[model samples]
Each structure stands twice: as structure tokens, then as C-alpha cells.
Target: MSGVITGERRSADTHSARSGGGAFVPEATPLDDARAQLAVATGLLGYSDGLHAMLATPRRELTVAVPLRADDGSTMLFTGYRVQHNFSRGPAKGGLRYSPGVNLDEVRALAMWMTWKCALLDVPYGGAKGGVAIDPRLHSKAELERVTRRYTSEILPIIGPERDIPAPDVGTDEQTMAWMMDTYSVNTGYTVPGIVTGKPISLGGSQGRASATSRGVTHIALAALKHRGISASRASAAVQGFGKVGRDTARFLHQAGLRVLGISDQYGAIHNAGGLDIERLCAFVDETGTVMGFPGAEPLDRDLLLELDVDLLVPAAVEGVLHEGNATRVTAPVIVEGANGPTSPAAARIFADRGQLVVPDILANAGGVIVSYFEWVQANQAYWWNAAEVEAKLEERMLSAWQQVVDYATQRTLSLRTAATVLAVERVAEAHRLRGLYP
Candidate 1:
């Protein structure tokens, strides 16, 4: 099957650089942890300290005050941010999320992850991310549309087909992207589909892009299973989130012969020894707004899904699902990260110590950006590929990337997470050295 590797793992490390108190800054938020991640990776990748310091930070961050007109008779003000982590390679690209916990730090981290993610797949993009601190589920569609359109206008100066592009993150979707594309086009006097991806198919979005992240996670999980000589058809799996990524990933794996044992959403979790009816579970979540009341499965506390007995565990929900607190209790032999920064670096090491294989988010969930790049290319050319072509291309890219990371990890005697960081950081450093810093 041509399982040869591209190179050795880079050896990303612990955060030894001094913060204010010379104590390691906890890898809590995305930006704080992204800097720490780069610091560790720079050491392992052997970048010059100057370059390390420069790369440890983002290029720019813009925070806008989005004053929204609620469906009710009141006006509410929300804070939004867009952070372009690095654009040495190309225009910045990432998703814009909405959540009460969204912040500058988290946006920074996700943008940084985008950089490595692009580098890892050799895609022609840098990292960027935006977020707003609002509980989007609490609002009506009209209110969300207003907020999205306004947010798009506020960030319009830095966004376009050739500048930064936004996609769906947490609390966002094709409709949101449709609003963004429409808003941007209205400002420019033309339709520009490339300004955003993950939009409705009728609005020039790729057919499979919405499920790309979940598909990519499925690809990585199967690769891990194949690498360990475990037949996926005989394997059991658990998913820690029931959002788009988690839900679709479960359905894909189930269709591929894996037994999906448990699943969770924000509300709660459900489990069955044989396997949950993924299609049924999806329908239940669709109608009920959560997986708590599914007919055929028993419920578990949300936190306990991480330690479930399974062959592969996919954390597709929020960050920090596998942290210092729960790393020791995790039972899966492999963890395929579907969310950025799902596992703390130290916690990853603990998993490795226990002989577990972790496919980091950068490598595993890269299907979204790969297809986003396709959308960008199409937008620029004013031509679009069919759904079959897009799916074929996505499968090819993610499968090849998985083999590359796996090969590097095999050759370097390192974890896939370390190898992924090392490969990505080295490529980025080379790009930086070639471009040089401008005066």
C-alpha cells in the first residue's frame, strides 16, 4: 500500500522558555498554548532562537466590537476577534467560531495551529482564526444572521479571496458562511465565493467540505488501526462530541465496519456495548438538539466518555478533553484528535508512556483546510470542481499526509504528535529563512 514515510519526526518539546515568573505558562488557551507549542517544536526542530522567538508569536490580531440588534427589542454588544497567525507562506485561512469562551488567546492558538496544519499538508496557506464571545445557540437565526453579517463587515478590511478567509468553527455553518460571502460580495459589488468556504453548495461551496474534518478524522483512525495490525472491522470506537465533526465521524466509521460504542454532545453521552446506531443517533440529535434522549443507548456523564473502553477514541468536540486530570484514566489505545489542542503536551506524553498512539489535530483534522484551499483555488479561477473530484482530492491529500506522519514517527521513534509538529515546524522555518524578514 506504499506505506513508506516522508521523513523523521521533529521532536517538539516541553515549554522551557521563561514567562513572567520563569514558570511554564500552562497550555490552557489556544494562543498561550500555541506559543508554547511552537517553543517546544522549535527546540526539537533546531530553529535559531531568534527565529523561535519570532515564530512564537502571531503576526497580527484585530478585535472588533460587534453591536448586534437582537430579535427582541434590545441591543446587545458582543466582542469579536480575528487573529492572523502567520502569512509568510500565503494568505491567512481559518474558521470563525462563536462561544461564550471565545477569546484572543484561543483565537491565537487556533491560528497558530492553522500554520502547522497548512505546512503539514504542504498546502499553500498560513494560519488564521476568528471568534466571538456569544452563546450562539441562545439566539434565533435572524439574530445570528445579523451578527454574522455585521461581524463580516467589521473584518472586511482584512478579508477577501486574496487576503484572509473564514469558515465554520464551533457554532458556525454553511449558512453563516453564506452570510459572510453575501456580505463581502455586497461590499465589493460582486459575488466572491472564495472569501469563505464551508458555505451552502448552491453558493459555490465544495460538496464534501462540511464533513471534511470528520472524514479526515476517520481516515486517520483507520490508518492508526491498520498500522497497529488491528482490523477496523473488529475495532471498537468512542467519540467525545456530537457536533458536525463528531456526528459525521461516527457515521463514517460505522459505515466502515468499526463498532461505535459511545458518543457525547454538550448535553450528555450515550453508550452501548455492540454499537450505537449512528444514523439513528444522528437523527435523534437532529430532532432533540442533543444525544441525551436516544432510544437504544444508556447515558453516561460527559466527562466519562474519555475513559471508555475502546480501540480508538476520537475527541471531536472542545479543546483540553485529554488533560493532566484525565490523561491517566484514558483507556483507548489510540486517540485521533478532531479538535485543536485536544490533548495537552504533557498529557500526550503520558499517553505515549502508556503505549498509546495519538494523531494530533494538525494532521488528523486537516481535511477542512485542504478543501478550503480547493475552494480558494476555485474562487480565484472562477471555476469549480464537482463533488466527486473534491472528495477524491480530499481523500488523496489526507491519506498521503497520514502516511507521511506515520512514516516520520516510525523512523524517529517518536509519537505521531511530535513527528507532525517537527515536520510542520521544519517546513515553516525553511519558508521563513527563504523569504527573510523585511525591513
Candidate 2:
């Protein structure tokens, strides 16, 4: 484990080219924070260094070049990545992100986190993540489809319904999954709906799959608020992202009686101390493509939204938004991470010291994967579940996991993140031990 850690540090330094010694000290990345969290869990479990090393490393990874032909006949190239961090428990499962910032390291971290999240939730799957470094917003519908198909085709050999399943994430959506499914199906000469989740409902997507993450986040947020003795009607929240996860999260939180005071997207943020009309705000975004200039709220500095003095803060945006610089200024007594790795190690430690109730992303956002599991099951059986049944099952699993994490945290005096990760690591390690190494 020490050797592995040292090697990672050296790799980080090598990537840096800012120092006189050709070192550009980069900021701590999601992978750095992920390994740190795993270290804590492995230490708590008293695992051997060999096992620790295995848990820290990705099982397989692939990088590909994605070339695109624009409508005007221009040529562009993008890098794409697919990482399967672990498959000890079952098939690898994670999302396919399309963003300008997508990189191998970020995908690795997300895949690793998916491993723990699946294990923690008792989902029969390991962890995997895929991404293409192109901004979906900057491309046309046809261009995005070409990129998705090209990227999917590039990685088709490694992905399948029974191997790795890719869903939507970040800049991608159900339409993206549809493209991936079509590309993979065309190559295989048949439909393989199970190859991906979060597809359009007509194509075997589960009834409640689209809003699973947000619904899951809200469920855990309400539970966290209650655990902290905050009532939904009296509680106020600020959501820091307005994408796939954040938009629905804000709406659901508002629906559940939380005064959603602020909402932000990459362009800007808006605030209404009296609780913004989420429906109207969502409509405004639909019409104008941004949360800024909503008639019902005042414009706010995007960064300041995180520092708002709300009862609960939900950072559903990108990674490292709430770092050391802004963690202390964050006034929300309870934070439910709606995005993966939204809180950094330093920020997590600060929150722990302050006795803040921070719900880790793995637990808070497991709803998507949980429902993804359901969608996969349905696809395999050729029998789909209704929305009510899906939502009920999702809530049952989410709350059960929440109780287990809370109990473990209380018994061991560990933060929720540590407790959840320790439990998950223990489960995955036990599975590995039982399976034994391949000859």
C-alpha cells in the first residue's frame, strides 16, 4: 500500500510541469481524494497491504480517440476513456459522462466510487465509468449523436449487458444512452437494451429511471434533516448545480417542503430568500437555457451560492466545488452531496470537525445505480416494473442503506463516509477472498 501511494505521488509530480524541475503542481484531483477515503476505510478494516493495493487500483482501463465530422465538414478529435475499477462483486456498472473536463483520472475516481456505492447498497455489481472529453452543449444534435456512436463503437468490445453497463451522467442523458444502445446493437446484429440503463422508456428503460438520482438524493436529504432535527417545512436548501441531478433535486426538495432558496448552473445562480419557485425556475431554464435572469429570483454570484446560510446545502454540481477555501464559509448545518466527490478531503475533515452532518455522495446518490440495477433486471427478465413499484423499491433500499450506515457510524464513531466505505470495502474484500485469484 505504501509503495502504491508513493507511486501515485510520483505520478502526480511527473504530470506537473510548473516547477523549475518541470513540475506543475496540480490541485488535488478526485482520484487523490478517492484514494484517501479508501485508505481510511482499509485502515479501519485492518486489511493487508496487498488487499489495500488491489482496492486502490483499477482492474482495467481503455483510452480511445474519438474523431468527429461537424455539420460544416470540419474535423475534430476528442479523447475518450472507460475504466472498470473493480468487478469482484459482480459486473461493472457506472455512467457515461460527456463533458469538456472529462479525463482518465476523473473517470477512474468515479468508477472506484461506483464500486463502493454498489457494494454498500448491496447491488450485485462492481464499478465502472466512461467519458468522452467533448462538451455536449457545444455540439449539435447530429454532432452529439455521431460522437456518442463513435465513442461507443470504439469501446464496444469491452462493454455489454453482462459485462459493463453505462448509463447517463454529467453532460449525457437518456438520448445519449439510446445512441450507445443503438450503436452496440447494430454491431451485434440485435437489440441489447440491457447494455445500458437510463434509456428512453419505449426502449426498456425502467419507469422511474430518469429521476432516480434526484429522488434518491431527496430521500436521503429528508432523512438527514430529520436526523439533525430539522423539519422539511422549516428547512431551507441551496442546490449548486442545475443539470440532470441538480434540476430535479431542487424540484423534488421543493416538492417535499424544503424552501429551495437558491439554484445555479454553470452560467450563473439565482436566489430568493423567500424560496424560489422551482417549477417556474425550471420552466425559465427550459425557455432560456439557464437559471440566471429568472423573474422570481435575484441574480447571485455562482460561487456565493455555496456559502449561503441555508439549513441544508446540496452541491449537485461538479467535483471539488466545496473545497478547503469554501468549506468553512459554507453555513449549511447539513449537506447532502448530490454530486460525486463534491466535497474534498480537506473539506470533509473540516465538516467532521465542525460536527456537520454531511451525507456522502455514494449513499446520497446511489438511487440512480439502484434503479439502474432494477432496469437491468427488468431488461434481463423482459418484464418491466411500474413507476410506483420502482419508486417503492428504491426508497426501501435507500432508507435501509441509510440506517445501516448511520448505525455503523454511531457504533464505530466514524463519519458516514468512513462507515459506508468501510462496510463496502469489507463486503468487496470478502467477496474477493471467497472467489480466490484466477489461476
Which candidate number has the best lDDT? 2
Worst ten-residue run, lDDT, model 2? 1-10
User: How would you encode candidate 1's per-residue C-alpha lDDT over 1-439 as one tens digit per residue?
Assistant: 1111122111111212223343443445445566777777788877788998777678888999888777766788888999998888888999999887777777888888999999999998888999888778778999899989999999999998778989999999999999999999999998888899888878888778888888888988899889888899899999988887898999999999999999988788889998999998888777888899799899898777888999999999877667665678898998899888888776887898899888899999999999888887887887889889988999899999998988898898878887888899888888898998897
Residue 64's lDDT within candidate 2 is 94
What alpha-carbon RMSD in Å does predicted model 2 have with respect to the real structure?
6.0
lDDT of 2: 0.90
Number of colliding residue pairs in each model: 2, 6
Q: In TM-score terms, which candidate is top?
A: 2
Worst 10 residues of 1 by lDDT: 4-13
Candidate 2, residue 365: Cα displacement in angstroms equals 0.6
Q: Mind giving the per-residue lDDT tens digits that candidate 2 earns over 79-194? A: 89999999899999999988767788889999999999999999999999998887677779998999899999999889999899999998888999999999999999999999
> What pairs collide in candidate 1?
30-109, 31-109
TM for every model, in the order presented, reads 0.92, 0.94
How far off is residue 305 in model 2, in Å? 0.6
